[model samples]
Target: MNLERLKQEFNSKKKSILGALASGTDASPKGSVDKQIIPIMELLNSCPDAVTTSSCSGRVSVFLEGRKQSSTTSAPKQEHGADVAAAGGKGGDGRWLFVTHDHLSDDILQEGQDDAIFLDMVFGGIPSEPAAPRLLGQLSSETRYIHFKFEPMILHVLTETLDVANRLLTCAISSSFRESGIVSPLKNPVVAIRTMGLAFDSPVGVYDPERNMIQRFIEPSGLKLLARLTNDRFRENSIRIDSFYRNLLSTMEAPETPLESKQTRALRKKVEGINKGRGIAATRENRVEIQDPLEDGIPFLEDDM
Candidate 1:
């Protein structure tokens, strides 16, 4: 379709999706946009050329895979849009045991307990350990496994035209979303903003139905370390997201100039330094209060411009 027609369609779709979000009827598993990414989503949707289709503001999760099925037995169906793909299990049905977009709380950790017990608490299940191994003939029909995962932020956006998509992708990559790219170029162009470098996943344990327990592999200390690292990645993800927002805003305001030009980069660095000195990180909650020249009325000289 032509650019004008594409823009029209995108605008219409944007309105419908935004309306669904407001009404809490969006099809995402969470049923609404994450609060942390709301400002970014709003900013993109405000532009006539772009709208976000899906997004996750990053999360740490414990997932339980469905039971493995025999060749003759078909896998069970998944309900509630359970994220089987994210679990990477053979079974198509898997569910999240525990999930949070924010850093894990310290209360989840307890001294002198096995990681299995901690995981049980996290999943809101009674802590238990396997009492005895099943005999060969008494073995359960299927095996179930659980995993711990920390995923970085990911967003998919549809732009009215390829040029607009490219500009957005540039902003994403510059903000450390190295895996961001144009998913579709010829028609209905979609850009995926993401980074796999910060993703973390590890096998937690296997579940024994007979024993009603999870047998964990990692130690308690190991679990604590994982939580710490996941929280660190969360902070970095937030910083990058803020940078992407600023870069996009600059691109929108100065459409004729390259955002990465030496002068523009220097100006950006100066602004960042000022914010850092003031102990300010541009988060969605505080973005409106930030006084960047780009957002303020301050004008740039011809050379800086």
Candidate 2:
């Protein structure tokens, strides 16, 4: 379905859960919810028990802590802490975001008198529910186009409902082991199909209307989508025919200096000077042998006569 219809479906489901919680009723017994509820439930399951510096991976949580300070100043205050170590700010922390496959089922089962509390337990904080249309605007097409929109919304609920400052910093790498489809090396291919972090103002929970950007990585077709985003021929980073030809011509005409100028000169001098060295050496014994041998033979012959 289109974006509008998908959003309506999510809101209706969300309101139902909130209503049940408000009325002090359990939405359902555990695991009795719709199939689309997996993402949110997984998000809930991923929350950390306490803050620690372990290799925790899940979804990052962003929230406001401490009492509200004086808001009467000219500049407003930020809700979430600002630091790279605190990568749980608004607009998401990094190039990735995730929604568990089992979010909705858990939300359905856990929406009780303490539903908000339960949500906080799952996500980091309860964000102000933005206007429905605007909220839809924040959800990327990859998420909206899903056959089950509840999956992503449930994930958002778990992330937005957490009572702590952060959640597990996690992600799902798509599996490369698909049977018929492209069997990429991805571990969790479908996770990429979900929308990324929602853009809002600083402080994590506040939904600023104009200051937001939505992003998503769709699997199976993600490469195609990426090609579209980066295929701008006019972009400088893209290959240019004219530039490539010009570079080729310049390289062809340029003389390749394999040896340095000093080395070439030294080699030439070495070759020329090699011929000037001594070819052979003569000794005085050769001259003496030619002159004395004749004199000795004449004297001996005269005596014999």
CA lDDT of 212 in candidate 1? 62
lDDT (0-100) at residue 35 of candidate 2?
Answer: 38
Q: Give the deviation of candidate 2 from the true structure as CA RMSD.
A: 36.0
Q: What is the lDDT of candidate 1?
A: 0.67
lDDT, candidate 2, equals 0.25
What alpha-carbon RMSD in Å does predicted model 1 have with respect to the real structure? 13.3
| Candidate 1 per-residue C-alpha lDDT over 1-305 given as tens digits, one digit per residue, 9 for 90 to 100 | 78778778878887887787777786766766788888889888887778888889999988777755443443564333243333355335667777888987666654664676675655548354432444334345455666778999888888777667666666776777776666556665788888777898887667665666766665567767788888899999899889887877776677464334434455446544554554455453465343442342221111100
**Candidate 2 lDDT by residue in tens digits, 87-132:** 2222223211223322123223332434445334323332223234
User: Model 1, residue 163: displacement in angstroms?
Assistant: 0.6
Worst 10 residues of 2 by lDDT: 296-305
**Model 1 lDDT, residue 148, Cα:** 79
Model 2 residue 260 CA deviation in Å:
60
TM-scores for the candidates: 0.71, 0.17
At residue 203, candidate 2 shows an lDDT of: 20
